[model samples]
Target: MFLVTDPPEPPATDAFVLEPLRPDLIDLDTEAYLTSPDVIREHSCGRWPVVGFGREDNLPLVIRHWSDHQARRAFTYLFLDPEGTSSLGCLYVQPLFPYLESMGADAQTLLRYAGGATARVSYWLRQDSGPELAASVAERVDEWLRTSWPLDSYLYRATPEEEFTVSSLDRLPLDRVVIDLPAEPHSYLWWSAQVRGGTTRMVS
Candidate 1:
């Protein structure tokens, strides 16, 4: 089993508030993701709400996030507007070991990299917020993770230009995986079918 450190206090940011993603905030979170631009959705490896995303699709995912946070397996937080009335984006902090394993990294690579890094961090902003807000949030998050979080190193998943690789190992591209899954009704059966079919095409 993968073990992880207890979560740190939500970082204080000048631009927004960070709160644990809970079931009650489902509606706000769902709306934020469903309306996110295709660029944001593509960067999320199709895990974020895609075309045809709905409340029903978000419910279980939110519940799982809540469960995982309670179990300390992973943590998800919503970035709320200053008034705390709605979500602007989301943050995910996941244990490095499991993340690497999921990405099919071999044991040697895991042993070499996971020893120093504690978590893999990623985040996204609402498309309407514009690129300036996104850049600000990214800067603030990087500072928080480097200064406040108790870790020697962490992986920040971003676009190719923004991604900070922790080692010489090339970061795995996720486009094919994202392309294989159907845009609607993101479910296990469809995912399994796509994997077994071994059909893939470039996204561009």
Candidate 2:
């Protein structure tokens, strides 16, 4: 229900940097992932968080998956401070698989929305960080994606447990869908954008 109005600003002095996830860094990332549930509880929508989060038994699997950054399958990033010494948060990006995968659509459906270059993204900032920091990290990574990938538009979605929030293209004629999986109910307030003449813009 809110929107982002201002242009991106330079990151703060203690700004966070995004790095591909790696196995060597799991020990450092443990705390962030473990504490994520509490943070999610406080921040995500419905005020309801997932259970069994932060269980030691799950760390190994979580670490193993994100350890590799597969551009096509998925791109996971660990957010760290400027010094690159600690984990502050994380960001994940991939195609619209999670949102559109079970729709039973044919190739034409994919072409209509993706056209070979649309992406889906998710992110979370440490509970201790200011919301502005989360916004900045999103902007920085978005610009990076624009320059480094073949994307025409990217879809930023709220976690299923959270209320839908959009910025930048909040007022544009954007694509949307509610993913009501039997196990989980969530909505996607997707925003689409395209790069034209060296500038990224909402596709409206």
Candidate 3:
């Protein structure tokens, strides 16, 4: 497990700022989620933002994140515009153990190329932010992770547009895996599994 006695503060740049996700920002968070395209949401979050996901739907998640942050178990940050008036996206930083566990992959095998990295970092930008701004954000975050954080290495999961082979010592490439699930035939999960070429069993 990753443990930090004092987690570093969120990073900021001229293009955007990172702040811990909190209750008061639920409205902005909801708006960000609602405005983001389905593809972007799935790429960033690993699942679709369910239909009609609003402030009410986001409250419990924010609360859970707050608790996790306080416990130093994980960290979730909201990307905000320069003036901090709007949510642009989100960042997630957490230990790699849980991720490997969920994937049912051998830790030793996956960490072979991790270069002693203990944490996994992932982020996404608002689709409407435009390619130029998205590129800037990704570049800035990459620098911040290398310079500001205490960890020397990290497993970086990037969106399709940002994905690249990692040749650097500070970052490691994340290998993708397909998982099979049991879902009722014709259900959304079953459809998703089919599209991803994953096997899904019909639920009685």
lDDT, candidate 2, 1-204, per-residue tens: 011122123233457866766666676566675566655554445453356544355466556656434323556677888897877877766666444646543454455454445667767666666656665665666676555565666667664333222443343344454333333344345555554334443322
Q: For model 3, which pairs clash?
A: none
Each model's lDDT: 0.61, 0.55, 0.60
Error of 3 at 81 (Å): 0.5
Q: Give the TM-score comparing model 1 with the true structure, all chains together.
A: 0.70
What local lDDT score does residue 161 receive in model 1, on the 0 to 100 scale?
30
Arrange candidates, best TM-score first. Answer: 3, 1, 2
Model 1: how far is 38 from its true place, Å?
Answer: 0.9
Of candidates 2 and 1, the better by lDDT:
1
Task: List model 1 lDDT by residue over 76-120, tens digit each.
Answer: 999998888878988987766565566565555566445434566
Ranking by lDDT: 1, 3, 2
In model 1, pairs of residues that clash are none
| Global CA lDDT computed for model 1 | 0.61
